[model samples]
Target: MLISFAMRRILLPVLITTGLAALLMAAACSTAPQPLEKKSEPTFDEGEYGGEPLPGTEQVTIVEPSPGGDRFALIRRRTPGEPSDPRFQLWIVDRDGSNPRLISVNTHDVAWHPSGDRAVVTVAIGIDFYVYTIDLETMETTQWTGKESQRLSFPVVSMAGWFRDGHRLLVFANQKAYQQPFPRGLYVIDTRDSMTTGPLVKLFSTTCLGNQDRYTVGKKYVRSDDPSSGNFARYDFDDESWRWITDFPKDSLRFVQKPVPSPTSDLIIQARETGNAKQLFLMNHRGKDVRQITEFGGDIPVWSSDGSYVTFRRDVHRGEGARYVPFKFNLKTRKAEPLWPVSPDSVPDFPDLSTQTLDKLKPRR
Candidate 1:
């Protein structure tokens, strides 16, 4: 009787094992690997800028003034054909909507020269920084890529503009090769000679982000004993001198938009940060005309031809929602009014120069 009981127990366990094996085999056969459903890549079309046209503006760019009167230059990124990977193509409206002409297809960043006859741009593939000159007359593009590597460098050889002479171009080539440090300095490139100046000039060499001192082992973005502040400096090639604009305070918020130097090189109109707000300020040739124009603290101020009005986009952050509000400011009345269909995804269109700065609007010092 004991032997029979043991045999029964063994048979029961064997039967359970056989059932489980059969169930597993059936599941494996039923679930043969299926081919992956190819995911269609997101496509960005040519006219697909994510914003409505500003009211009274037909997707046209706003024109600010330069050295000459009524010189219009607009830049828009368009992937005209069926896109594999998107690249930015520049278009210029030199005659103000007469006919938009294609400038270059491989351009990454483009800015008109003070003369408004040419442009300075950076063209990069993956890690290379190639500074190129776009000739407006011939629509011919010339690139300068030999001096630097194309690594994912920080301070990214961005911020190009015509110097005081309009004969030379200034480029900020980021040599750090990473995002950890601020840009090393400004590099002055002669357009005619194609000669570059230096690897350092003390302009934006400090931390752009406000946290710099807490350099611990696991800490990110904190440099050891970094000043936790930023300072603006200008290199005078003529005098071989360096000047300080200001040392950004720790508790104070500050940002320097493009430094728009005057025709006479005596003043600069800057988009700056005050506390949590961004506003427009004009600095005289002596760098002292720090007067507040409009108080729409969140938007950037782009000057108009006569410095009479400025156009900008404001970001309104409300809890989980955000809205991009386009605005135009009249300087004489000190009033800012909203423009067009409001959307959180809308952004600023590339601005161009329509009229030139006549005279410094006597600084309100």
Candidate 2:
């Protein structure tokens, strides 16, 4: 289940529909054939980013932007027409939806630094997943983890959240390779040392869940979204356990699910069931002043780097088929426009641009 969650995370974010329609659409999307664009080399400049601010929130930072929050999750067969496991071919675009670039192929998971230039990416070799850091400017990939033995190694590593310091990672991994390799749980890894030889400390021993599992990785709590509803809980790293969420404004959120706190941590975007349809909404942290954002579909809504915009998926049905589209909604204007180079008419559609800053979603403590 957790491994499937990791695959879901690579697909980025999307809200599950209710009932049979939801299951059917999910099945359709899962089986839908995606077009494979010609791959491109990295085109980032060295001077594109610098200087970082502290991200907000306790488990996540609502203030600092998450660069990893912007990658579109996708499945691209490295060896076309061959039966194999699903591999991600990630596409990245600017917040305005311009400058679409194929970041990497055959990747597993990704976690970006607050700087929006560097990424901690995971990839599967044969049986185990390896961690690597990508410097967009220099276009270099560095191995972050290695193994000496099967029992003393992390067979699975998914970068879940980052600390405010930006050098520590809240990662999901399993120490040993087993016939059943569901991740052991969450652990802290410091990148201060060379990543390939970093330290690891266990945090919990439950079914380790991350953003890939459709849970919003927060500072004090991990908000897991149920297609039917949502739950807020606190993840106590110090105690190595989790507790129920406290001080939340859940006064009128009886029908909310897939709730994503913005990078600022002041507002949350959620899906509310209404008129037999699920639509997107934006409300305050207190859960007051609720307002509708999407009239129809708001699949996997995520905040942009600066938190001024909300990126969402729009499913367009034409004739007998439907295509999922990516759109950026302006908070100030209260209007949503399609991200550039992608539209309802575009073939094979596009991937999500922003998946939420796991670091930024940490509640302020």
| Candidate that would win on lDDT | 2
RMSD for each of the candidates? 25.0, 16.6
lDDT of 2 by residue, 19-83 (tens): 32222223223343232233442222222211121121001011112555544333232322323
lDDT of 1 by residue, 148-254 (tens): 33221342565455554666655664445544344445556676766666644533432111111110000111232453444454444455555665443433222
- Model 1 scores worst on lDDT over the 10 consecutive residues at 209-218
- Candidate 2 lDDT trough over 10 residues, lowest sum: 53-62
Stretches of model 2 off by over 4 angstroms after superposition: 1-87, 94-99, 124-130, 145-152, 174-183, 194-231, 236-258, 271-278, 283-292, 318-320, 341-365
